[model samples]
Each structure stands twice: as C-alpha cells, then as structure tokens.
Target: MATEHPAKARAPHRRPFQVATGVLGDLMFTTGVLLALLVAYSLWWTDVTVARHTGVAAEHLRQRWSAAAPAAPPTGTADTAVPPRFEADDGIGFLHVPAMGVGYQVLIKIGTGEDTLAEGVAGAYTNPYSSAMPWEPQGNFALAAHRDGHGAKFHDLDVLKPGDPLVVETRDRWYVYRVDATLPKTSKHDTGVIAPVPTGSPYTVPGRYITLTTCTPVYTSLYRMAVWGSLVREQPVDPDRTPPPELRKEDPSNG
Candidate 1:
C-alpha cells in the first residue's frame, strides 16, 4: 500500500540571473553606506578637527603678539603706512565679523590654497601682489575661506548687509570695514573679485577695500560669493587688548 507514496519534493533551484542580481544588490547597498560615511566625515569630522587645531593656533598667535614690541603708528603716507612686511607663516591677523555670530573670529593666514583654508582659517590672496595687509593704506585686503565645511568661517557671509562691521584685528590695530556691496555669485575663475580695485561690484575706484570670498550656495563650490567693503577706520589696540566699538555692538545680523 505504501509503494505508491509520493517521492520527496525537490527544492527549486535558483536561476543564475537571480543569484547575480542578489549579489549586485548587496554590493550596491554596501557602496551606498560607505559613501554616506565618507560624506559624514567630510562634513562633520573635518570641522571638528580643524576647529581644535585652529583654536590652539589662534592662542599661540596671540601669545606671540603679546611678546612682541608695539608697532609705531602709521605716518599717514601710503609708503609709511605700510607696516613691516610679514611672511604668511607669521600669523598675519584675525578677522572678526560680529554679524556672523558671537565670538566669530578666524585666523588670517597668507594663502588661499586648500592647505591653508582647510585649517579652519581665512587666507589672503597671494597672486603675486594681489592682496594687501590690513596695515596697508590703500589696497584690497582680499581674503577667502570655506563656506560650508572645515569651520565654514564665512558661512554666514550672506547675512551681512550694508553697514555691518568687518573687523581685522592685528597686533597693534583693528582695521574696521563697513559692508557696502555683495555679489551673490560669480565665476570661480574671476580674478577681478580680489583685485586691488575689485570689479563686478559697486567699487570702481581704487581705495582701501576689503573683499571676503567664499563658495556660494553653501555645500557646493560651483561658483563664488563676494562681499565688498571699505575701510571705515582703524583703532589702536590698547594695552588692555580691548576690542573696537564695532565688535562691542550687539550682533544685529545674526538671525
């Protein structure tokens, strides 16, 4: 009676195409996870590391300034107004934008190259005499920084409006600038934005101007954003290391 019992059912074999598709899906998922981790490191971890390094650097710079002798006042002439020419490695100065945020300051170094800006600091353009020091009487104090990552020193640049203070703190003086114009976007190759008399803005005459440049649209570097300002005044850094009146004002544009 059991002779006619059904044979054991066999398991269905998976097709080769199905096996290949499953493996491909798994590979794609792993790749996606790796990419996400990379992005997170770039956007988050870089900022953290740079901030820590830059803070220590900034403190060292201030200590150096304190140890140095006081600088003589500008003699009014352009030639005399030019302070001692300093190399980039000497820690040029500090940039403070009250409108950006409380305690919003970054070290000023001498090159706009990636290596310099990646240290979470602003870099002065050095295209063979394209930039000027804050102590220089009349030239573009052009600077560049990252807008989204690596401390994003100029990320809040778009919030600045006409009349906001852009202060540059040096060992002996505070070079104050007032925001006058902004170009929301421009070609990254446009050298004129950092020129002695920067083009593509309200500036047409040569003067003591400041240019703050950063990549536009936040996370991408497809283009550039420029902020133009005129040197409003200079205040001597007193013995007490007091900040200027502009920095003392409330941050009105930090919304």
Candidate 2:
C-alpha cells in the first residue's frame, strides 16, 4: 500500500481576517459618534451667541433714549406733551409685570419692515397690513413674538391670567393695561374675542387695546395664543412719583 502524503496543514489566515473586520467596525462607530457631537455643539453655540447680541443691542438703544429724555421737558407740564405717534426705543424703559417677568424695550416701527422682527426678539413695530397697533385707540393692536426654545421672548405670556397688569413705559408716560381674556387659535368667524371692546361687535373702541400674540402649544407654531388687555389707566412719569394710567373710553367706536 502506498503511504498517503500528510496533507499540509493550512495556515490559520482566517483569524487575521476576523481581526481586521472587527477593527474596521469599531472605527466606523467612533466616526459616527464624533459627527453627532459636532453638530450638537454648533447648534448650542449659535443660540447663545444670538441671545448675547440681542441683549447688547437692546442696552445701547436704552442708553441713547435716556440721554435724549433728560433734554426734554418734565412730565405733566405744558412743555412735556405726549406725542400722538409712539417711539420705539432700544432698551426696555419699564417692566410690565413682576410675576410674568415680561420686559423688553418697546419699538415703534412703521409698516412692518423686514428688519422689524429680525433680531431674535419681539418686534417693536406692528404688522401694518395684518392688524392695528396695540397702543392705538382704534383697530386691533396686534403684537408678535417668538415662543420657542430659540429666543423665548414671550414664552411666559401663557402664564398670564385675567386681571394681570400689563405696563408700557416711555420716556414721559406709563400706560397700564389689564388682561381681560385669552383667545385660542380660531377661524375668522371667531371674531368674538378680537372684536373691538365689546364682544361680537365690528366697531373699535376709543380706549387703548393691546393684543399679545405668540406661538401656542409651547415650542411649536401649530397655533396662536393671544392675550387681550384693555387700557385701565395712564400715569405720567413724575420725577418723584409714578402712577398707573387710568382706563378711558374707546374713542373711534368703529375701525
């Protein structure tokens, strides 16, 4: 019988292949994790930078207004008369509510320009085409602000309840408004809440009316949440004492 030649043992190259595959898999997973972390860091930095710039711009504007104010006449005197048109300032003059912590420098811009609300904060001007000015005696004085996690300017607006005080301070005067009702998102037919002073009426009231609008559902733009307040009082900014504005009757009676 011929002796069978011993089969040469094959070298264990399969072990090397398996080891290479494991290393590749681990590298791919590490790359994916690093990419995800970079993206998250970028978004966080962007938001914080924007907020800082907004605060700086607001402060600069306030300083300018303060300097100009002292040059003007004293409140309640014939020399110091409130203008029919409102002026938008850079810094917040007076805070409205201590509870809600809603404070910002009021701005009055005409015709809803592109840059009106571009600064990641509440626009100082009204959307001239959409609604009337909130401080105006006639028409719906509508105001808009961001409600998401971005700027969070009007985030606390929903917390407001009926009878909450809303304050507006200028260089010379302070306007006081009281929350009357809250309106949910609705169709045009649901004009009961937006109707002038009286419910279900087309006519506008002579007294000042304010409508604070922001995105509803907290952090989503699915709907609009509006808080309505009517002018309750007007107080002149006195050197020694400050008082709230008195409620006055709506003047125009019709839009």
Candidate 3:
C-alpha cells in the first residue's frame, strides 16, 4: 500500500491590522512627498519667477532713467527737500544692502501692498502713514519686502547691526543710511514702526530715518521685524553710476 502523504501545510493568513498598517504607511509617505513639493514650490519656484520679473523691471527702469532728463532744480529749501513724486507703478529707486549680501539690491516701489512686494522688490509704505522719500529733508522713509520666499529680498536683514550701511540709489543721487537699532520681534499691528519718527527706536525727534520692515521668525507672519536707520549722508551719482563706498565695502556677514 502506498503511504499516505502528509497534508500540505497552509500558508499563514495576514491580520487585518497588518494590512491596515501597510496602507497607512503608504499614505503617510505620499503625504510627506506632497508637503515637501509644496515647500519647494513656495520657496524655489517662486524665487525663480520673481527673479525674472525683477530683472525685467530693473531693465525698464534703467531705460527710463537713461531717456529722462536730469533731476530738475531743487524747488524746496534746504530744510524742506521735495523730490519728484512717482506713481506707485513707477519705481522710485533701488536699495543696496552690503550687510545682507555682496551684491544685494532690490527695486523700490511706492506702495507696500501685497502685489507690490510680490514682485520681489522693496515697497514704501503709503497707508496709515506715507513714507518719506530718501530725498526728503526730514521724515521716515519706511520700506518693506519679503523676508522669505518671493526672492527673500530682506532675508538677511537680521544680520544688520548698528553702523551697518543701507544705501538707496535714485537716478541722480544716492541716499546712505546707517543702521542704528532693530526690533527683532513685534506685533504686526504696530504701525508706529513705520511712522515718521518710528516708535521703539532711538529717535526722539523728527529726522530723516529709514525703516526696513519684514515678517519675523522666518516663514511666518505672526510678528514683524524692523531695522531702523538714520540718514547718514548723501552722495551724487556720477556719470558712471558708481556706488558709494558703503556699497562697495566688504561685509563680514557675507561669509
């Protein structure tokens, strides 16, 4: 008689929990990938687009300046400087911050609106308080830009310290400001930071000051950061469009 063969062993069945855990892991991995892509798009892709827009804007400004006539005779007295008022669509000048980077520069537009700053340029505040132009004899020239993404124009603003140079380049003149104080964090509702005489700053009287404001803590808009500067001096832009020594000086922060 032929020997009976042992019954074939059955394969173990997988528990429902095991299958559920595997599915959960796969979903988590997919979600992680999507989140990373979102961050990259927000930070990298946006910067790339902004840079292109910024280049076009700068080139147009250069052409306009070249075709335009020199600045007209001063209409206001020395104590009350009155430069030309440009429309918000027309940029007023360029900002140079050596402390921020070796060749850190951004266009300066009139209004500090979302659309304005989204162009990867610096914007002058116009609401609640109008910003004083760099040519103004006395008042605060408040400005704003994105601290992260959208070109991150003022990403290194926190690096600026007392005596750091911040230069504004107009068609005919260069307005140089010196960092005197900083508010690392403050409520976003604090409009006083951009006032003619910014509160919480060293200034106790009216003066020609510059305030650079941006969102604080990076990647978040919960608070605001401000860097206050005083108009240290002014220099005439030569035919060659040479920058001031402040702009040329090497900044240790660049390292």
Q: Residues 1-255, candidate 2: write the lDDT tens digits.
A: 876455645454468879999899999999999987876675456457657866776577556665664535544523344444544533334335533642333333333243444444555433222444433445555556566443455777878788877776655666677777776564433334444453532235545676666667774667777778776766556664344422212112321
Candidate 3 contains a number of clashing pairs equal to: 0
* Candidates, ranked, lDDT: 3, 1, 2
- For candidate 2, the 10 contiguous residues with the lowest summed lDDT are 246-255
Off by over 4 Å in 2: 1-47, 69-95, 102-115, 128-139, 187-206, 240-255
Off by over 4 Å in 1: 1-14, 73-82, 251-255
Q: What C-alpha lDDT do the candidate models reach, one value each?
A: 0.85, 0.55, 0.88
User: Taking the tens digit of each residue's C-alpha lDDT, what string does model 3 give over 130-248?
Assistant: 99888776899999999889989988889989989899998878888999999999999999999999999999999999999999899889999999999888877667797788876
Q: Write the per-residue lDDT of candidate 1 for residues 134-238, one digit (tens) a residue.
A: 766578999999987899888898999888999999887888899999999999899888889888878878789999999988888999999999998887777
The clash count of every prediction, one per candidate, is: 0, 15, 0
Candidate 2 versus the native: TM-score?
0.60
Q: Tell me the lDDT of candidate 2.
A: 0.55
Clashing pairs in 1: none
Candidate 3 stretches with Cα past 4 Å from truth are 1-18, 72-82, 251-255
Every candidate's CA RMSD: 3.9, 9.9, 4.1
Clashes of 1: 0
